[model samples]
Target: MPHQLAVTIRAALPAARVAEVSELLAEAGRKGVAGELFPFAEVTGVHFARLLVVPEGPPGADGAPVPASVVYMSEVDAPLQSHLTDLVRKAGEGLEKVFGHCDGYPTGSASVAARTAWLRAHRIPSAAFYVNTVGRGRQQILREARLREAIEEFLDQQGAALSGAPPSRIRAAVQEHVRGRPDLAWARSRPAPPALWWRIRQKAHLVALPVVALFLLPLLLFALPVWAVLLRLHELRDAPGRDRPDRRHLRELAACEDFGAQNPFTAVGSVKPGRFRRATLTAVLLVVDYGVRHFFNRGDLTGVKTIHFARWLFIDDKRRVLFASNYDGSLESYMDDFIDKVAWGLNAVFSNGLGYPRTRWLVLGGAKDELAFKNYLRCHQLPTHVWYSAYDDLTTATIDTNARIRAGLFADLGPAATRAWLALL
Candidate 1:
């Protein structure tokens, strides 16, 4: 399961300490997954992880500065509690060092249990979450990636000797190569299937959707006009964010970007005030959560496959939203993809945030207003202080490809299937 943890920096912390904390995180970012302070690889099952200090936005009605938060978020295979246990056990000293600067961290006790409890206390439940492919754990990914490389290496050494061979012959040779190697022997067998209860829940959710829709049909019809009127009224009077980001802010965001094949995006913005907007955003996220779990679990989110994991969470009494994603490619290309492929989906969720590009309905005309939408995103975007990826060399597409190759390695295949499998090499 993908999980996140966020803790607010103590507003009472001296300014000099905050600067030291920032420098510490920047140093970790430079060291990447193997940093001496917090080696991300030491804590297993994490696909991606990041530590960032993001603003909580402007002062509240009390006119006091809201503390900027130190967010430690990760996507892991096990349940969050289990992952946190591993995190504390493996990186106890490093975690204490980093989190000590934050508010609410137990000061006197440095025990693993105490640190884990604090992390649990500050945990934020995502309003919605997405994984490009469910059930693909870090261990499986690394193993299969190694499998692909070994097969490719074998093919290279055999060079052209198998060039004119039949598909079966080529596949047979590849299978033989894998079978003869101890390390690649795992690829000769299939992995365990998902648990029975998981399958049952998936099917049950699929079956229940239409039934629920039918039950709500009459109420929906009755409320349609009123809902439309309310939505249009809000849309007409809503403030649209059109301001350009400051040059220095843009530079700061860009500094940590484009360093790897994958990049981390963390943005926070105030939610549009009032019950109606909040309800609309809530409903949208509910539907998105359903669709991603039941529909988009197979590596695509509405034709956009670049994201490995993404999440949205409502924070600070639902007055603000935090959007974060681990995506492949440069940020420019990423924005273009959403604009070109799934602009309406962007409009659906983001239009409820303060200073978004205008939307006609809940799903149209917002992200389609490209320039304004990009500006809105840049304006809210925050610089990530540190980021890590388990497989920095692989993109989502490459991971899918590797999994497919592993899946077909020991399968009985027809000529067409064999040819397709060979093509994957």
Candidate 2:
């Protein structure tokens, strides 16, 4: 189940404009593909909903409207998100082409008031969604009292022209008398209203501040206790038996073993032809213990439930690697020992020679299995790749060979580390 984000648009607009914008919104809804569109007309106003599916979980199953987590408002009879503003602008351009010019004025006051009410209800973060009615360019200066008078007169004469006057009568009259230019023709214009600065200020003061405070308060409260625990753990780092053996020393010992003339496990260059490669690259490491399970389970099962580890490795030009280590049991009893040894081995290899060859390590659990590797990349910040696959049943020989290639064992480290690591050899 995926979480759903619902957005509602409310506006007072001419029926034609409302229908036009709604059609565009419906088109966008279809393109989103993951959600549904519902339009409702109330006595007070008209509204529509565009629901977006998020990957977490289904929002609400019942027929009732899902409580909106985020809202967007636009003056043109539709609610729009920041990402959809471009589409709205394109639609407006289409309208201008049909109407000749969209003078910044609303076609009707009811529509204007409805839009204002909707914007106020949503309390969007910015005013960029609002239309600018004042004409753009040189004629913008003409948008003042003089232009309003001229436009009103023009509309009046146009009404008269519809009452059986000659076609050229209104055109000649407008050009010769109203416009005072024989060649110029009158085009419809809609000048945008002045920007709503005071409303923006009020939103910052009333809505933004409170929301910001609410968001920060929980973080501050949780961080204090977590920080205290971390400080206590930091104090234990220097305690007895805490002095661990450096990995570089262990690698020296490993190097003494006659594996081959070519450093079999070194990250310096490509691995020897017959050597095995292990997939140990990881991005996130989730260490779960009995206590964590008990906390969630209310003292049901004991020991270790599952140890999940995520790794992303570049296998070759052909494929990318994503794997999870699913070890069942108490982490302290079995998994910790494995991690300690593996970390020692990895540290020895990397420190003795150079940095790790793999790109990233992801430490995560709970729902890692549910994620399609490519889909995960789409929503996450991991580097891009052409293809990804799960390597759950990889053989030891294949795994080791792939590891060597992916780890860049044959590649030389810097001169300093290479000289040091290979010095003993």
Candidate 3:
């Protein structure tokens, strides 16, 4: 469901400024991006743009999140390879679109064009990619227990095989392992379905919509004042963790209890598509949790950065599941944490119709749930993304970036936008 891409820009730019530049690039063209930013930053504008920096990673000096390279990952229905590079090139060109100026860097339009040419000529040296079609019964599969365990085990194995290895290794191994599997091949998103009764039902609401709007007129009058108070209250909250006011994450790493800490790695997997009803239900749940998830997670999660997690989930209209998450721990510890803390929860909510294992994961729902999840794991194996980040702070916090200053500017966008922005972190 998600077509992903990563390009390491070995530019002349310093890592700190590079991080800022990357943020700007990510924010470019997403006129529909919901979060607040300096009106000049253009983040709050809403438009149909795909592509975001996945879990802005690669910490630079002073604990700043300077990714080793800028990554442009998107969940677009279109073929990413065809246009993502171009979009990224365009993002690199329009400095004003993301930031407010073209000062402080050599990223002028001509320079950007030159850099784009350089990228094309040199070719991307290494990259990690994971994609699969959302199955027809993805939502239902996500709910299934037995199937979930199988999927997690497979993912874990995949990780193990490549953990701490080179990107070339991942590419070589995965290609070989899944050689016979046609399911994971790149493909277009599911086509639009024929209109159903839901359309008629939605049309019927047109008459009632006017009545509802009339009734809410009084509330609309008071909306601004109410919004003003909330916005002020939001300002009072602590700024985002991007500033690295206190690098608990760095401290955690220094004191990490695990023996022989693991290298940074990303794990990506997807579930097959599903029927329409499952798609509908998943959409409702996604909307419901948008705000709730945001309010609860304000900073690099205050201290969770110790694990150095940068993850996101995507469930499309076809009930396709695309999960991308990374962490700083050995395969063993990561798997242990998953089974102990995340497995059950994954099956419960995140899976949607992705289906068991591919969708559910761990399938360790309760004391009564089977231990099949454990059975699927081959601890000896490593799990690594196409390009496992040797950069531990690849997505860690940084002091160089100016995100903290702009965070408060975004405070007025409300919880959903906040949550959406956090997903980028």
Candidate 4:
């Protein structure tokens, strides 16, 4: 019964003000949270990501959805009725500068009329709008559990009916079984008690982590020049894929009408990572994701509509460290923000992975090859791109809602076709 709830407010602004509005939300999120760290490393429900609504329309001759409403969104976790109300009021203040006046969606905890209005608007199909920003990690796990259970239940119910059924028939029958009762496969939400490791890590990081980062800074800096030389040498060793990128992915992205704004140019690139640090690719990505994803969630970067979705398996990763993300601006601008804002931490992590001077210069993009990697991204990236939907979409959101639940249900369901059917639901 304890679901993630948030008082989502929508303010329509001119499309041009997306960046300015996003910055205000981030600033407000920081101030709203007041640097209040949650217990352990739990996600604070106090902040939210941007939701740029692509107006419903056909793409122009150029093949991009005509920009429509630029709605600012954040689902702050309001625990108490009073708190939710106040947060709504405070959020309105953030919107005023952009929307001017109190013209944005005005639903507040303190006001009965406003609250009732918002509720009335979402009376039907009420899953998308939320008030809290809890992480979907547990929800995702539980959802997968539910999907598997549903698959099992469907198989059992159709035991006699399925014996002579063809693949298509079996899939259709399973879909009929789960229809409006998708809840049959879902697990109830569980209480989130902070784990021991969380407690220890948080405590240690509070005092020790920063000092350690500072301590490691000079050494990381000193190794930069040496790292640059090695990365450049590596790029020379292994060149770009001779098979010109077919833009096969562009067709896929082109069909997508799910996000607010897009760069249209999708870059698909890969690097044959050096040996010494290649093993830790995932570990590094996760650590960095943990540290910086919040910044991203708080709108730290711009033109990042639907951050990393449809992350083409090969789009960002398919063996040998492939990465991808959409940007609001040009690739160069994206790289600049990345280096200035995020690269310091990434560089330090690379230092740790490559073992700094002990192993010395084996890591590409470790210290100085940041641009070298940028060049690689530029070269290999798809020249044009498209996305199907944004995270806010109920359909796409459900895909990862349980962390790719359809994929998880594959074993129990037997055929991928059956799993695919369930996913489409």
Best by lDDT: 1
**TM-scores vs. true structure, each candidate:** 0.92, 0.19, 0.29, 0.29
Worst 10 residues of 3 by lDDT: 379-388
lDDT for each candidate structure: 0.81, 0.27, 0.34, 0.39
Top candidate on TM-score is 1
CA lDDT, candidate 2, residue 94 = 29
How many residue pairs clash in all the candidates, one count each? Answer: 1, 41, 46, 23
For 1-425, candidate 4 gives per-residue lDDT tens digits of 22233332333345666556545534533344311211111233422223233222334347764433333323333343543345334444333353442234543333645743543342221111211112433345345546756766778777896887776666666556655474643432333534556546545655574587689999979976876676546444543332322355334333332244333233322324444334334444544444433333322332233232212221112222222333343445555655555554435333332122112333334434554545434444432211211222232134344444444332345576564654444
Arranged by lDDT with the best first, the candidates are 1, 4, 3, 2
Residue pairs in collision within model 1: 241-355
Report the candidate with higher lDDT, 1 versus 3.
1
Model 2 residue 294 lDDT?
A: 19
**After superposing candidate 1, which stretches have Cα over 4 Å from the reference?**
1-17, 30-34, 59-65, 107-109, 201-213
Off by over 4 Å in 4: 1-228, 235-243, 247-249, 257-270, 276-287, 290-297, 302-319, 322-425
